[model samples]
Target: MALHSASVNSKLIFAPAGKESHGQAEQFTRGILTRSDLDQTSPIWQFHKWFAAAQRSELVAHPETCCLSTASLPSGRVSSRMVYLKELDAEGFVIYSNFGTSKKAQDLSTNPWASLTFWWEELERQIRVEGRASRLTREESQKYFDTRVRGSRIGAWSSRQSQVLKPIQGDAGDEEDDGRRVLDGWVKETEKRFEGEENIPVPDFWGGLRIIPESVEFWQGRQSRLHDRFIYEKKAPTEESVQEWTLERLSP
Candidate 1:
């Protein structure tokens, strides 16, 4: 089911056969972003500003979500999934997950570079981050882990992140093709293991991964498709020099 059309005045007016055109096309005149609007010192600071606006806007939901992408080695196959942004610090952005069996972990094992994309459509803004991913210290991970609800913590320990789930043979009728029982059984077992325990330890295979950005780009949509873009690139530091970032305007 492919609905296609050419853009007129930068509005994507979709035309599908035997149907009326979809919702009214909108021109992106929400805001005009400029270089001076960004923080001169750090991309992190600028990101915080935009992030705060997104959080406050009624039009945005789940503003902390972003697309995380990784590429497998040798084959160079790329994979992406939506993940919640768990924390941010002076160094970079952080998210937590099973770092053992997940495809992302496997990719990171071979290639450390990864990318994150945040698209706030209602605000007509996007941000791209490219960085090297490294595991957060166990102690640091525990700090975030302790904040999770009990069930999520149990889930982190119960299931292998990316493994295929196959229902046990002869355990149920043909209707159970999805193998959800296997997951339910694991969850029940995990629950019993920690029946009355007040505290749960973070699994060794699960924790936080922080992406130290080499480059961060901010984009804002405009009318006529002439978008605004700026990028902050990290610079290498010498023995006597501290780290620094250079900001440059990008052609949209």
Candidate 2:
């Protein structure tokens, strides 16, 4: 086997030996199972094994974090990037980014629909989720943000993300002086904003987006091009009741 690099949003492409076309190789590579191989099981148990394996590997490798993609209104092109997955639960996957951030925040405003994919090569598995996202409560965001290290909290306050960085040349002392000034300004502003509370409040623009998964599909690779796949679909409630899901197998 031979591997090569192709610049597609900073992602790598691996090809087998003697493969002539990258596109053909990519299509072949993505030929995993469809939604027809799963057996009837509880939603949690249907893909328990694969999910556990993904979690274990993610803990160590943190494969590509989480990618957030959104389509702008009318006919604008879509944009995506790698963001950290903060938490995952029965509710859905949770991720935090500044509300002032461009792609995510804007998309969430117009369209709350999103998708998440997790790929684990060691396990030959992939999990994809599609869902609607909503903002987490202030209490939830504060609880998580407060647990971060002091330096991280300070950094969050000291820097403006997604903004251009101006070049400034100076000696070590001058740099130190600049940093101190910025830090001091942040400290004073924060103190005044929070009324001198020792526990810093979570920034209003920083919070979490909880994706309520409407569908989750799990795929596993097998030899001879025969693969296995299962998809779980969340059932809508007719009345004011809890949501339920139905599992279905898809054709490979």
Candidate 3:
């Protein structure tokens, strides 16, 4: 059974009684977004501009973090998770993950379409990217893999991501029993396997997935709930190597 909003609201309580509006929503005054503000040439150039601003802002932390959303085919069950944007080029945006067992990989196998959402609340801005994802070649993936720390490289080899973990059987009250130990043991084994080795090989199951965007949208918040939105959509299917984009404004 679902609870009504009134019932849910009645039971909610916070610190400092009578201070209902202490941290309430405020009118957005950061800046206005307009059609003229967007880059005429390419959305990637525009994204670079906003992203550089985010990187420069003192209030923004981990600007590369974004929500990656994927939907499984047939049933179309959607799932989303936070992932770091590792690399971006003229082609697309790249993120690394376990391609063998992770849920996103499973979804991508069945449905190549995916979307990424980046929200910077402090800046009152958001960006949405919808695209088709494909795995990067082993050589390309290896290049990025080589840049990761030793622990992370080992972790890539250790973890069978999205797989259910089982703790050793024990009495219900046994505090020592833990499912996480299974992963820790795998890590220890991987560590020993590469001991004294200067370079660890990138696991075949882990690599980068690049999202080649078909459309990208930029949003900026405004007062009175009226906001600004601009979207860049692929012009059309073409055999040409270089893709072109058509920009338009969306009603708030």
TM-score versus the correct structure, for each prediction = 0.88, 0.68, 0.89
lDDT tens digits by residue: candidate 3, 1-252: 666556744635444324553454677889899888899878888989999999999778988999999999899999999999999898888999999999998899899999999999889999999999999999999999999998899999999999998887667887875698889889999999999986888888999999999999999999977999999998875687667899998988
Off by over 4 Å in 3: 1-24, 170-174, 237-241
Local accuracy by lDDT, each model: 0.90, 0.67, 0.89
Cand. 3 Cα-lDDT: 0.89
lDDT of 2 by residue, 1-252 (tens): 336564446645445434653543222253455444453433445445555556676643765365777666655557677787787666777887777655667777777788777767666667777889889998999888888876566556554556544444466766434334544566666556655455877777777888788888887776654667678888876487766678766666
Instruction: Write model 1 residue lDDT over 25-97, tens digit each, in one string.
Output: 5668999988889999888889899999999897889888999999999989999999999988999999889
lDDT winner: 1
Better of 1 and 2 by lDDT: 1
Instruction: Tally clashes: model 2.
Output: 5
